[model samples]
Target: MAGALLGALLLLELLGGGDGKNEELRLYHHLFDNYDPERRPVKEPEDTVTVTLKVTLTNLISLNEKEETLTTSVWIGVDWQDYRLNFSKDDFGGIETLRVPSELVWLPEIVLENNIDGQFGVAYDANVLVYEGGYLSWLPPAIYRSSCAVEVTYFPFDWQNCSLVFRSQTYNAGEVEFVFGVDEEGETISNIDIDTEAYTENGEWAIDFCPGLIHHHGGSADDPGGIDVVYTLIIRRKPLFYTINIIVPCVLISGLVLLAYFLPAQAGGQKCTVSINVLLAQTVFLFLIAQKTPETSLSVPMLGRYLIFVMVVATIIVVNCVIVLNLSLRTPTTHAASPRLRHVLLELLPRLLGSRAPPEPPRAASPPRRASSVGLLLRAEELILKKPRSELVFEGQRHRHGPWTAALCQSLGAAAPEVRCCVDAVNFVAESTRDQEASGEEVSDWVRMGKALDNVCFWAALVLFGVGSSLIFLGGYFNQVPELPYPPCM
Candidate 1:
């Protein structure tokens, strides 16, 4: 019982000491708490993000002999850090963010120094830089900074044979790079994984690393790596074949069509037939020419213009040929007024537009009894005039002319004026008939000669024109596909 009491007393004292220790700890120490719930104050980094960049181009432009400027646009891509806390959006969902509003990242004026020719001020001019894709978003899980870069280069003349080189220095990033190879069929070719051959999304993008310039054409993650990507594209100057097969044959047929004018209508079966054949040939050529040329509403080709000229000329030939045939089919009675006009306008105009004189009016026949009496008088007067024994005979030949003609020669003989009028009328008709006969033969000869001449001209034109057209086509064929200007970067 005594030991128990001592233990109780000790325990009470120990409890009292523990109580005192608890009171002391409570005065100076505290229990574990959610200190974060106490709302500790913090400061965010400045919203202003600074960026500085310099770009240099190497061999990005080419000039003609005159050094005239070629226009081109370059694309620059930059990836950097932007210190922004928050951003807004518009109803259209466009990122509504504040822009720093500075030309910190810009293209500097580049001056091309051509030492060989000592030409200056012939380089990149002051051109506006079009910006794209520089916005901020705050909806992500974490607040991350964003950055971007652009490709700033120029392609000199037509982009078909131009290359653009762009170099950008990002002060914030140590060395950031990307690879651009021929995106063949959308299959990317990389320097490291070049062995892996891939296809394209479509057949068009057969992107491949240019064989010769590859060493300095591709990009690398390391600082000293180089990249060059050459995109060889096949674009036609005009969407049609400059072919002799088209132009030569067409020109030749056109030349042949010109031959139609030389064929005479009097040739019966052959003349019209030949002209029709030539017309058909020309039609074939026109069809062929249309096929050979591009199907565009653009201006007609020089050759087409010439062919049209030929066709028009040929149509005239055909029309003249028809006229000639009409003249040939005409009877002497129907053509009595103007036989010469018929042959000339109808026949000769087919060869060339030659003028003809108007024909004489037809003679009116006297009554049968009057005609017999005049014939008897004419024969008697002619016999007597030759004898010089009868004055009436001399007068008869003299009166063969018209009354007007006889009156003019009235002093020559007694019955001369009347006799001369009769003889003159008869002689006029006879001479006209003789002239018609001679004209017919001459026209025939002329027609044949013209056909021959036309044949010669057509053949000559064919050979010469064919040779010229062939040379043009051959030159185009041998001509090299223009080399694309591929800079070191792209």
Candidate 2:
């Protein structure tokens, strides 16, 4: 520190004398004043400059699937040899290095065209360190908000390819250009050491492959192309979270929809409510799926498509419940069973399904003596009503009212035959009641129709539920197998 202070005092004294004999200070002034501002850092007027770049990805900012935008931060070191910026060793007290304003020397005008406009991060050639041998290297770090087209055909289990395209703006192919360095002195660049170890792995995404290279593409009508540095980033979804939280729940809900069919038609109202809830659950999952994937309709996500399919099947189940309830509640007086329905559902379908109706309850036996007397009485009454008085009232009355009433009728008949007519009238009344009781034993057509409908629909629903869920869930399982390939399906 004392030696540097003494050297500063000596330089100040020389500058105070105004004779301009200070070698170090004068060398700095002379170099800056005498430098040609128009000259480039090249040996020949048209000699191209070759730039070598090394990069490191620091962090990921955001990836917008719907808008297809990716924002990240990176650090790049650019190296190039400059002849115009070199200085003689003997000029300034044998100084071997000099740090000066970067604008004082020529710098490459390479820019990343894929970067989003109006949101570029601050960057500048802040300080340029020039060595005595004309070696110029600049290390600048920037947060690049680049956007790329996103393909989300297999979302939640999907992988996307995005790129950072670097190009030149100020210098074109006509004047200054760029060339990519394949190796450092014929040694391959280490791509695996791109600062990935410290990367903050996103909760929803994982890096598949990050390969960067330089390639010169031909010019187009819009702009002349010279050189481009493309850093390809392939990222795939981390689907464990979605599979457990979203996909599994959705699948279980779909299974519930299939089970809704098992609820008896007697619970049709409850079954309809359950089916509606399944639809609502699917709707919620569908919304979540839309949030996870891009807006393109090129293809549907496996989970989203599955949810939609289950929703459709659930709607059909709702309709089936309505039909079952309607059939089960029909009344014989208002709605009789159609012949076609009876043949198809009651007879044909039951035989096809190998099903049988529930047995009716046992009935009490009629009194044998009463039944025989009634049968004889009915014959007498029927004969009396059709064939005048051919049958004797005393004979039929004895069976229906017993021998006491017959004897009373026979004694009364001696006075007047019309008086015995009372016994015949009682027989007629009993016969009418027998017919009404017989009709009550037969099952009503409406009840039989309803039971037939319930059995048929129950078996039919079983088949549909099995087939529908098997096909749909199996398709989803195979489609979402992450290890099938880089791009499994579109």
Which residues of candidate 1, in runs, are more than 4 Å off? 1-209, 212-385, 388-428, 443-449, 480-490
Error of 2 at 174 (Å): 5.7
Q: lDDT by residue for model 2 over 1-490, one digit each (tens)?
A: 3245336747686668443435444544545555654566666766777766666677766788877788777776667887655677676567666655555666676677887655443355456666776777776777777887876555566777788777666665545555444454885442312554766667776666666666766667655567777777777777799879987788778778656656655677898999899899889889988887887768877677667777877887789778877776665445656688778876786678787655767989966676756688668756766553413655566666889987776676766756546656777778878876544432344445555666666566667656765775566455432342233111
Q: Which candidate is the best by TM-score?
A: 2
Which segments of model 2 are wrong by more than 4 Å?
Answer: 1-39, 85-104, 120-132, 174-187, 190-193, 219-225, 287-302, 338-340, 347-355, 360-402, 409-490
Cα lDDT tens digits, model 1, 1-490, are: 3245335545656677655443322321221111121221122322222222112221122222123232222222222232212222332134333322122222211222212333322232222221122322111011111111111111010112322222222211123223433344865332212112231122111222222222243334653443333222221233133334555566666566545545554653465576567667767767765664445453454455555556665565566555555545545344442466545444565446333334546879965664435765757745754644334434443446656654555555544566656756776889999989876755544444344334444455446545654553454444434444532223
Per-residue error (Å), model 1, residue 297? 20
Model 2 C-alpha RMSD vs. true structure (Å) is 7.0
What TM-score, to 2 decimals, does candidate 1 have?
A: 0.30
Indicate the worst ten consecutive residues by lDDT in candidate 2: 481-490
